[model samples]
Target: MVQLDATTQEVLNRISEEFAQKGAYNLRQNGVALCHGDSEHIKIRKKEDKPGIDILIDGDTKGERVFIPVVVSVSGMTDLVYNDFYVADGADVTIVAGCGIHNSGCNESRHDGIHTFHVGENANVKYEEKHYGEGNGTGSRVLNPVTNIEVGRNSVFTMDTAQIKGVDSTVRETNVELAEGAKLYVLEKLMTDGEQKAESNIEVCLEGSGSSAQIVSRSVCKGHSLQTFHPKAVGRNKCHAHIQCDSIIMDQAHVGSIPEIQAEHVDAAIIHEAAIGRINDEQLLKLRTLGMTEAEAENVIIENFLS
Candidate 1:
């Protein structure tokens, strides 16, 4: 079995100590990874193959929290999977997950992911995710992600995702769940350029009275690429939901946002909003009139928007 580097080993050690202080936990070096907690049914596996990195998450844990670290580099083509990390009843847990790619080597890559969360009554969970890519290579990337959440009465679940740049990339997915007397919030962002494309399908269904859900999304597409965002909200009796998506386009780039709202009960209230547009040409002309070159004008806009 291959061992982790000194830096990774130190990180594992720190997490293990933290687990011990909470009592009734164990930590050990598994083949190619580290394991923590006395979790029997839960499993995290990482494998390296020609296509790229492969990860597997199985079952739920009874612990207070669960943590997993993933790193992958693909010079050719790759595909990956992320199973849902389950949260036990009346237990609070946090899942911090991130993904990065060696954009220079790989010609193409795709990420296939699914997250199933079981929120117990009166429990709370915090989930965060980050995705970024780099390299000058020309290829295509597809990210298909699905999140299934079941929130018990009076529980809370929050999910956030940040996606950086990619060329000729496409992302599509769905998020759905049932919340009773609880609350759910989702925040997502995407940035892209150069023939890139991203599509996301999001939906939230409220089944419990007094339950609420909010969805917020922002995106930027530049250099002839296309970006699309679709968000839907459905409310039942005495439930409420909100959905919104915003986007900016540049240099023949294209962006589209679709927001849908459905209220089945008269007691329910739902709202949906969407907006997409490109930078102002007259503003750039004004910059040029002020002695700034065309290139400089565009650069200024990018710096102001991204920085």
Candidate 2:
């Protein structure tokens, strides 16, 4: 294993703990790939023409989860990476991916990552990714991520993505296609403070009979930040799909939620819901009665709501 600097190590720890990465692991810093684990069922290697990693999970493999962490600790740098994941037929696996940036300089730092997943028949995959940024300097922290997923017949795919704090700007896009009897579930959580801006767009297609999908997104905007969310689901067969978007807006912030559902077949069913509001005064009052400060009470409420 390769050694990391103190600052880089701290950033990695914040994203994923060391003990949680007992299986296959890959660590990347500032567009450079380093420190990858070796496993028979899981394979991780660098791309031939890009600063990225390719991960492959063998068929019928079921055991510990795979962990991959990417971090950028320098300022004035733009990093781009492309990750491709291939899961074999009848395999069951879990993947944990974390990306973080620690920029303490006057220049802006940004990361753009594109991920594509190919899930085979009867396979099940659970994927989790978190994004975070921390710095005291005047630089902007930005992240742009795009994901594409293809699920085979009778397979299941679930994804959970979260962005906690300190990111100045972000644009996230996701697309998924489901085959016969395939299922997909996606959960997204986001928080923006200061003058940050974020935009998220998701599209799912149920192309085969008995395919189903569900998408849920929650966001909090504070301190003049701006956020926009768009979720669209299309059912082309006798499938079911649902989408929900919820947001909390505070302190001169702005948030917009747009959800669209389309059913091409007579037996298809699709629904969507969206809600945007601020913290409840009744809840805040109850917390204040417990001897908690206003700020602390608000924080508690936000944490609980997001959780």
Candidate 3:
């Protein structure tokens, strides 16, 4: 692994210790190491106007594990991109990605990120991603991640992701394609508590026989911020798809959810349901009478519904 700065190196060291304690698989790329079967710190490196890293498949027929942690300290019109992560046949892999930014005082600091993954036949992959940002500058950070997953026959994939408040972020899209007998499970979550904008777009396709996909999403929008969720799932012949999205609004915030499911074949079964509403005053009043303040009551609603 490349030697990291003190702060990042400490995160990596902690992950390494956890790996030893849990007996997990270790993955190394360009000297950077990550562990499977155990959680590890995300890998973050500074890339000046270029693709950060690319993973390729060769020689080995088995899959590999990867961990990515990104810290955006760039200021003044910065750009960064990365190539796709490749997974080969008859193997299983896991990826844990984390993104965050420091308190840069620049007014025009922004970051753009892209991640792509390819899954091969009979392979299984589990991916988890988290985004966090905290700063007091007028500069806003943007995150546009593209997840291109091609699941081969009998392959299984799962995704769990969460986005926190601070800075403006929009996930352009999450596109998934499944092969025969492939299965996928996805959980998308977002929580906003700042004076920023947030949006998420996710799409899944069941393109082969016996393929299936499911999505569960929860969102919370507060303050003067706005949020939107657009989730779509498509099922072809003999395929199955399901989607569920529920949201809660507070503090005069605005939220919109559009969930749709499309199935073309007679043997296919697709279902979608979505609901958007605000925290009722009746509920808040009831909680306030129970020794909770207005802010506390609203927080309870957010935690129970969104978290």
Candidate 4:
């Protein structure tokens, strides 16, 4: 059994607390705190040529879960890692991953993570990731993440991502490609407060017959924060694709939503929608009438909006 430092454990609780338990996760704090595999069918190990890890899920496995989380607690530290996941054919699993940073110094703390997933034929995978930052310090908190996924024939991949905490700056990008009869679904939620800035870029390609994809994003901007979202989907065969981007703005905040869809074949179907607006007065008034303060009402709306 392995143990996590108090500070690191506290931060891990913000994202995937249950996986922080020993013998249940592959966790890295500042460096490799602990790394282990779930079973013979599942393996976790370092990348001999790189600074990250590789997760291998065996074929025909059913009803399994894996967690790999990272945390950074040192001020003035910048970390970069590349992780890869390989899911074998006919397997169904859920993967939980996230990064949390706790910095308390005069220098900036930043983390950049690149993840790539290969889903084999007929495999079904659900992936979730969250980002958080907390500290009382003069330094800034920053997180940038890049994800690439290749879904094989008849496979399905679903992704959920959220970042609603004290990050000062972030740029997130996701790219996906679907094979014959494959499907890709995504739901993204974000919140930016104070002077934080966030940018999201998503692109997907439905390149095989019967392949389909859908992407949706919801974000809230408060104070002087800024956020921008770009979602694009392309259909290259007898496939379907849709993209949607929506956001809420408040108190000197700014938001931009850009959605695009393209069809390259006569049988390809694609559509897109985008909207940005402020908090609805009617919604706020209703909450306030229930004896909640204006600020409290706004908070409630923001929380539900992101959810």
- Location of the lowest summed lDDT over 10 successive residues in candidate 4: 17-26
TM-score (C-alpha) between model 2 and the true structure: 0.97
| lDDT values, one for every candidate | 0.62, 0.89, 0.67, 0.88
**Candidate order by decreasing lDDT:** 2, 4, 3, 1
Which residue pairs show backbone clashes in model 4?
none
For candidate 1, the clash count comes to 5
Q: Indicate the worst ten consecutive residues by lDDT in candidate 3.
A: 15-24
Candidate 3 residue 125 Cα shift, in angstroms, is: 1.1
Write down the lDDT that model 1 would get. Answer: 0.62
Q: Candidate 2, residues 243-263: lDDT per residue as tens digits?
A: 989998999999998787888
TM-score of each: 0.73, 0.97, 0.79, 0.97
Which stretches of model 1 miss by more than 4 angstroms? Answer: 1-66, 280-307
Query: Any runs in candidate 4 off by more than 4 Å, and if so which?
Result: 22-24
Model 3 has an lDDT value of 0.67
Better-scoring candidate (TM-score), 2 or 3: 2
Find the 10 residues in a row with the least total lDDT in model 1. 23-32
* lDDT of each residue in 119-217, candidate 1, tens digit only: 767767777666555545554555565667788788888888767655356565766666678899888877878767778788788888999998888
Candidates 2 and 3 compared by lDDT, better number:
2
Encode model 3's per-residue lDDT on 200-266: one tens digit a residue: 7887888899999888898888777788888888887698888988877767678888777887888
